[model samples]
Target: MKKVLAAVLAGAMLTASMAGCSGTASSSSSSKAASDSKADSTAATSTASAEDEALTCTLNVWGPAEDQAKDKGNWLPTTCEQFKKLHPKWNITFKYSACSEGDAGKTVTQDPSAAGDVYFFANDQINTLISANALSELGGSTVDEIKSSCSKEIIDSVTVKDSVYGVPFTTNTWFMYYNKSKFSDTDVKSLDAMLKKGKVAFPISNSWYLPAFFIANGCTMYGDKGTDESAGIQFGGDKGTEVTKYLATLVANPNFKNDADGSGLAGLRDGSISAYFSGSWDAAAVKEALGSNFGAVSLPTVNIGGSEKQLKSFSGSKAIGVNPNTKNPQVAVALAKYLGGADAQRSHYKLRSIVPCNTEVLKDTDIQKDAMVTAQNETFEKTSIIQPFVASMKDFWTPTENFGKALISKEITKDNAASKVEALTKAYKNPVS
Candidate 1:
């Protein structure tokens, strides 16, 4: 068990500048950890003891299909082999499966006892996993390494109360992508400014994408940090109605189009829309669409009422987590930490272009130069809020979606914005879930 801890420390000792396409064997080290003779000696002794223990177990690990694909570098099995080498005592047989991070919480909770011993999940699912007793809390040197290797915001994504339940590997959020030929750098800074000069497409009807407007104008969900359920949704009152009116006017603009069914990307491809909002998952498509004119940036400010307010996206992380029900609790926990460790993240980035959340990995010159990484990190730090994961949040989606659909259909005009916003607020407070 401590052998995993030693491996983490050793990985932290490797130069943070190692940003190459090496597999898990070439895991990068963090400068944040103390590098001393005593620590190195202890690490060696721990490895020796772990070899003596010689534990053998069979465990199941789960992640997205891309990670398991040989064409994609087989990130899962490759990293697993590296972990096994660190704990030579553990004769681990890993059973691989394709369960994307987005579906991990639902799939696991459906039959947690039978789910993978180690798995990947979107950080917003932390509360749900905890509620089902599916996620195990991390502690000791593993917890210490995690804290030292990630940003506070990244750490907060997997934290419940004061305990961390998962190790985040990459950020999850959307930002702005525009056509450089259509908008100047200055013009791209403001959504309202950009709209006047070029066609803009937004997924206004998406429940996930709808809150950016409300949040920009003093509205809140759950609570300030998005963890307080009793605080309910503060999307009513003057501020909320003001945003509602602004959105109504926005949707009615001749240059604006509601992005639906990949219509935004489609429009970008045909030059029908010069700007769109999305995440790294669309980077290739956007790049292919715009060629040399491609541009990506953190979300821009939106004018609401009489003032300019910064538009924010819902932000979180995709993380590696261990099932609390795993028979091999120690090994499962170790593997979870190893998979999300800095080295694994660097490899994931090199092999799959997954934007890493590990602070040390983010410092590498190559990783620093990636346009999509910059956009995502900037949004995480400056233009996004944690998406709440409390059980009560389940009630938020449908109502918000219905509200956005109404806006798209022009059912809520400036005249009816107040009443409609109030009704939406009520629905949030008295959610069906």
Candidate 2:
């Protein structure tokens, strides 16, 4: 991933710099046009109206270490400068530090006032932020603009109870990373085919990856959006048992390896493993291991009910949220919007190699040319399921992993699969207090 990150960063910087020049030229032409046009008076009136609504405030922001680092492109500062240029009346001063997206909710929940007015957070943290009243709801023109600018999935991921809570900047998900030398293009399309080549590493016992099986076989976790706690676990049903039986067969296969201890990379490096299911986080290491043979694609299809079913993986987004406790809620909301907007998402893709969630940015020819970004985008579009962000989902991980372990140990057979699944479902339904 870092290989692509460096490559994309170089390209993105060039693209951004060129775009900056183009923008300056466009602004100059617009000034000439304004001087010559009769509509100049109307445009001036509109500009004045916008300025009247403009705000003035200092915004303390939080994001990952990369966003804060000067040498790493300092994306936040650049974005703020662009935003300030658009709304010059908004006297936004930013004080930023390293705060992981996953940690934003906890920090705000613990001390709302001290938390940054705007912060980047993971989509899964939405429910927690909402429950704690730590997030401000975006409304009116802001909501309309976001809905128009981003993909539906991106918009839907941050919306709760018909209110948008976060501005999604990039998608976060997993896909298959394989060694092209070991498997041909056709061979990588099916799980069974990949397994036939050599050992394929996946964390089958981990709750995060385990849900893919049940989900592909028509199971629901929590509810449609994972908000209905009463919906319980639907994986224990007939469809789930069928999927479990199929997974048991693979678990029993000698080519299957559990990646619980993080040995998969070592195995790949030493030629003991040919493929693994993971996300962008593992890209740099895996690229070094496979070198020229490294290849990434969507997850392979699994055999279910005598037919091939596309293997589904969970999808998530890293988003920007406004603190409800901010002194200037409107400006904070505007800043959050600007951070997740098309230009910001493009900058993020260039600076951090993060997959942009903005629809227009995703369609960029440059972004489409990057194999890693293209593969991830396609996989999320066709084969990924949105992971629920509901608070009740906190109870799901442990019991699901336990169930996976039991299956791997040959404790869940075709005959007894239903019973074990039922037990696991019961556990998941009963939230951990």
Candidate 3:
């Protein structure tokens, strides 16, 4: 979600003077959603290669918007420059834009002629474009190696009926960070009591609330992939609808009204909200927002199974892929291989505080020592990578957005929700992008 609708909103909201840790609904709301246009390009030196007659040229790279892009912090242009210094034979021209849901892949799909050698895109969309032959297959040997190194859940998500596409670099899941001083054990009796007195943070309207409530109730975002080794989008069907109904129940009750109002971070600073569900990347900022009064916990669990069940945080990562149509597939492969390894992952992890999924590098001493990094590793163990319906999401987002708006706006009633929601889901068609 970080690189889809969520990623676009993050870039717009968190740019420059706006930089801070907070969640938003679209690609423009935060600095985390990386695209291709934010890369800082160096005017090419155009030096002739010692062995070849052709001059070394820059490789065009696409990524997300960044608050601080100098020296390629978080954008491919900067990462490419770092690669260029090591391999002077390769020059990369980077462009970073916080792309909308399917646009990252479609940018190349729509115009194969106009593209950088490499592209950074959300995982699900990569499946679509890769299958359509828009992006290069990462070859047999490399794919096998990446498979062993990345999470199996994530690997399975981007793989279509059979073939695999794209590599993951970001796993986004929720963590419950709280201002410890405000909700000390003796002061608050229970979660219900805390909510009654306005002791919660995070937005009710955000998708994060689902896992929060579900784990609290005991559910997962995915169902078994089946004997064919395929999974179902279990989060949004009848069970998914149950999730919505439960949310409606919570917010409509008026008992939880005060705690559910507005963005959750506002409550954290006021001492009114003691705990919140947030992405791992935002923990440092959440700490700053709450000053010295905070403590971090894994996302809370909601008992949903017959006995007791816990909901885990979502897991997955963002990645760079090569355009299959590129005249320079070799360069594209090199770029992806580099970023997916330890050097770039660690540098980005240090500069931006984002989590890395590369198994080979995640255990590096620098990565393990950072406080935020340490916490991410702790929380990640509790999560399952939630799979969005490759096509169901396309069919789901708009109507779901509208339906959620109406529910939040008091324009719709649960009595009529079945008919309305069904019609809305029926309309959500998966895009081929």
Candidate 4:
């Protein structure tokens, strides 16, 4: 299959060159004719080299059930079909199966050889996937095309050690979802103001959302950008304790609610909650519940130590990765690229309402008009912080969750906030030890 595609590409290049020479033949000098002939020869040689590197193999692909379902215009199967058309002789048979993006990293790490040749996963898994030697690095034209096609932040999310390890499909992060009828535009900008209007459901017990408070107070998880595993936890000292005390106050407010389940969505639907903190995954349901009253915006600022600080949500991306252990490594990489490419991303947007990461797709006027997409873009630009992909980050979730729960439960207070912060910092810095 690869050879056939190569031959066809080579023929096309040579034909185009020959046609150009024929058009100029009557006016061309001997030197000019020789130069054109040389150019043609170069084209043929490059095509031959590319053909030699072309891949021919069946690939196993994994993604969410919705992305693989035939009825949903699943991008995986559609992408595979399109890829096969481009590489006619390539005997590319894709075995599609169910695997959520969140589980892909752990699955690949557990058994690289048995994992899918191409799989969808969250960006936070890059460090662990690379450490397990489970992901393949993209190179050559593929890497170039990816860099040209996606946003800089999207590209950076999948890049490790200056090499791209995956192709980003969609951004996976939280923005603010609120009931417009309950709170005005100005009301939503201040967390304190929103709380006064009605109950606001935020999963304060979850580590994912808990960091927003500390981040607003200028606390960091690891060193700069969450890299440098050796740097350990920086969520201590004055800023950390200050944020902790503030959170203790917020949780004590009657309008503050802790909900980890779909209860928040239920609250929105029942008109009991004015606003909530969550991502695009809940956009559809919230839209349905609020109808014309639906409003999505960037996270609001919160009062901290007598000053208001912008709440910074953790930002991430969902991407497609090639397994390093695949028998057809090149084919796997190609498949990963195809799944996250422009066409596939557009399809994802139309079918799933997923905000595409592809630069061209994002520029589409219709995509730009989407409220969710616009709000998310604004959030990423103004208030989002990149979630680190380092291995040490694995230690952050449990300790942070415990700390958040303790604060909400009234077990940690202003007087004891410093000591508790110190102990949690020590545990986070030496999780395994």
Candidate 5:
């Protein structure tokens, strides 16, 4: 939004820059495997006549400005060129548009038919895109490749009603960044430990960042796998109150500070804070601030009510999707698959420091060596939960944000943590229209 080793080299130098497409992708296995096999066959034979005819078409594609950069070898255009070479039968004229993955779904929903035939989007927008009938149900080797390349959770994130629609490129989540000189290796594993020893900043007032506490203490949204809308949100009762009480104590601690208005990075720069939480987006600033003292890790455990709970960040992916409205469905699907497959992800990493979510690419010698990649991959697989993207999720943010604001304002206290949590739970279920 947010490590391993000393990472003596600045992560900024390693990764380069952060793009805004935050969130990961995923789907169910047995059904997906069967679907993949069937689709693989159809993909091969369905376009046979088109291949012979040498179909020519003008294709519109959309992605982040970073990928379209001419200076960086034009990842988007270069990849498109490569796709053209592979499908020599298809004479493709590329038309490009600058659209961030995070904004893809909303923008496309406004006018799906007018949107690019192929585009990159955040996985959390799956539901919204589906509701608007803006996302196409992907099939063939593209579906097979996605199944083979990504983790189950990654696959599930892009799935709506058991069908996968997007091809994932990289993980989207947050982790801890610390000054190595201030905290020991063991200390980095525990949030309370870091807080006790050095100045620590956390985004306690932000809804997106606040859920780490509740998630650690057993709160869940849309059930365990985050796919069941009927399950509703489970962020209530004794478990929710426990987290509220913990946060109250955390905010009252002298060594703790709430990150807001860029104070986290400023604190790191001025040497006022020893550690903070964020995603790959802040790597450069953190690296420049701490230099040789830079360190990173997955979310740490927190001691809550005499018990240690592992804090889990919300994780998702940025992926490439196809529009069913495309007149040239065959070419559009092929191009979409090519852009998000392992090869494209590798190129994306080289060009933009966009970490790859493809399992095969993650094992590359160079990729494996990057400490930031190691930390991010670990957090994506271990200390993270998928952010539910169902329509019901719209009711989540404001109420959670209100709770966070109250915590920072001291309106929420250990003395009334239970009552406050009860109120938040009610708000979650009965969000005002």
Candidate 6:
């Protein structure tokens, strides 16, 4: 049975512990026009008046727990407050957690029928849940509104059968970022120059390498064309082979190493490393890693036997989603709309330095003026979306995780990685394919 809603009153915001500066509660175009930087904003303005008159109306939310500590705006408490303030008649309770690589498959198995009103899911989980009907088809109400505010690309994995079930959440693209204090102007011009001549490190254990290299080498990591079955990462196919060779190239590079753990952020902070492949949000981490000495670029483009794409980074931005089980979906949808709008997304970005899905938010002079944001838009448009399937995190990502672990550990060699991926792909579709 679904739980009753309750007022989302006061939870200590853990924003101070997160990186980035505080946001100034102002979204004026003129105010934002001069600075290219967005600050982390958490001013206690109860703009959502609806929350005041609300009672026991709950909203179940599941997502990355890191946001709890690192982001002030996107998490359950903040978003719920914003939502409740708008619809004061409906009080909401939130369930939160951070599900990452190893823990991906374990939790969803516990309560499929009533997991939460909404969950922040990825590509690996989609197919598995589709057959089980554990997921509610987002259908008519809120999905398009989400698409309008956030982006359609953000929810690509959750789209199936010409219909969308999940609202856009998690930018979910993978690539590399660098610390410039460790590099120079000449170092970034080319891949060969940077790899053999500059300092670099990458988190080998993280599957970021697969999609990063696959795309850098001009190979398809996920399908680009929705209509073509073989176009995207469909279990096992050309993509797996491309992934194998791409890994081989990086391993062979003397400037790059397999033992590296975290895109050189730790090393940059410690003054031992200079550059590496990583996620977009790591820009803050990079600054934390090498304060006053950080500059990053898209991961270097490379040759996979001989295909070529530009360098890019891994991304994971989240959006608001509505639960199918909600008795008052109209209110939920309205709240979700407000949450994903420019005002809310911009505020959240100020709090977390997350790139906004609302294209207009990006236009805010403050955000658009940044050199990195300008450079990133190009990459974001072209790079691969490497998140796990959105249907079923348990069934899809676990096998993919095992495959990733195997690939990184050399248990699956470059020569055989393709075949292994094919096996995993078959396993992914399990009874269906």
Q: Quantify all predictions' global Cα lDDT against the true fold.
A: 0.81, 0.74, 0.52, 0.75, 0.78, 0.50
What lDDT is obtained when candidate 1 is compared to the true structure? 0.81
Best by lDDT: 1
Candidate 4 structure quality by residue, lDDT tens digits, 1-433: 4323433444454444333421322332322322222222234222444334333456788888887776767766877888777655445677887989889878878887678878889999988887776776665456677789877887888888787777888888888888887899899899998898889999989898888888898887666677767767777899998988888888889998887777788889898887888887777778899999889999999999999999998898899887765555434555566778888888788877788878888999999888899888888767988888777787888998999889888999888989998888887865442
- Give a tens-digit lDDT track for model 5, residues 1-433: 0011212222221111111101111233222222322243234224554355455568899888878888866999999998888777667799999999889878988998788878899898888887776777765456777899888888888887667888788889999999999999999999998888999999988888899899899988888987777887777788998899999999999999999999988999999999998987577668779999988889899998789999999899988887755555556766777788789989888777788988889889998986678788889889999888878888888999889989999999999999999888787774333
For residues 1-433, could you state the per-residue lDDT of candidate 3 as single tens digits?
Answer: 3224423432242232122211122433112212211110011122123212222344556665552366435444567677667665444355554553236756766764465456777675765665455665453334655687877765765565565556667665656666666566433324444555555654555543444444444333334322211332224445545555655655575434322454566666665566776765566567778777766655443323222334455545566776654443334555676776667777777766667877877778877665555555556665444545454444434554565566677665656645554554445432222
List the candidate numbers ranked by lDDT, top first: 1, 5, 4, 2, 3, 6
lDDT by residue (tens digit), candidate 2, 389-432 = 76668778898889889887888887787788878878866544
What C-alpha lDDT does candidate 6 achieve relative to the native structure? Answer: 0.50
TM-score of candidate 5 on Cα atoms, chains taken together: 0.85
Angstrom error at residue 181, model 1: 1.3
Give the per-residue Cα lDDT of candidate 2 at 163. 66
lDDT of 3: 0.52
Worst 10 residues of 4 by lDDT: 32-41
- Order of models, best TM-score first: 1, 5, 4, 2, 3, 6
lDDT of 6 by residue, 164-218 (tens): 5555533545444565654567666455567766556765555444445544544
Off by over 4 Å in 4: 1-56, 70-73, 430-433
Per-residue lDDT, model 2, residue 333, is: 62
Per-candidate total of colliding backbone pairs: 2, 2, 54, 2, 18, 54
RMSD of 4: 10.1
Question: By TM-score, who's the top model here?
Answer: 1
> Which of the two candidates, 3 or 5, achieves a greater TM-score against the reference?
5
Off by over 4 Å in 3: 1-55, 71-75, 91-103, 184-198, 207-223, 226-245, 253-262, 270-272, 303-309, 312-314, 369-381, 410-433
Judge candidate 4 at residue 278 and give its lDDT: 82
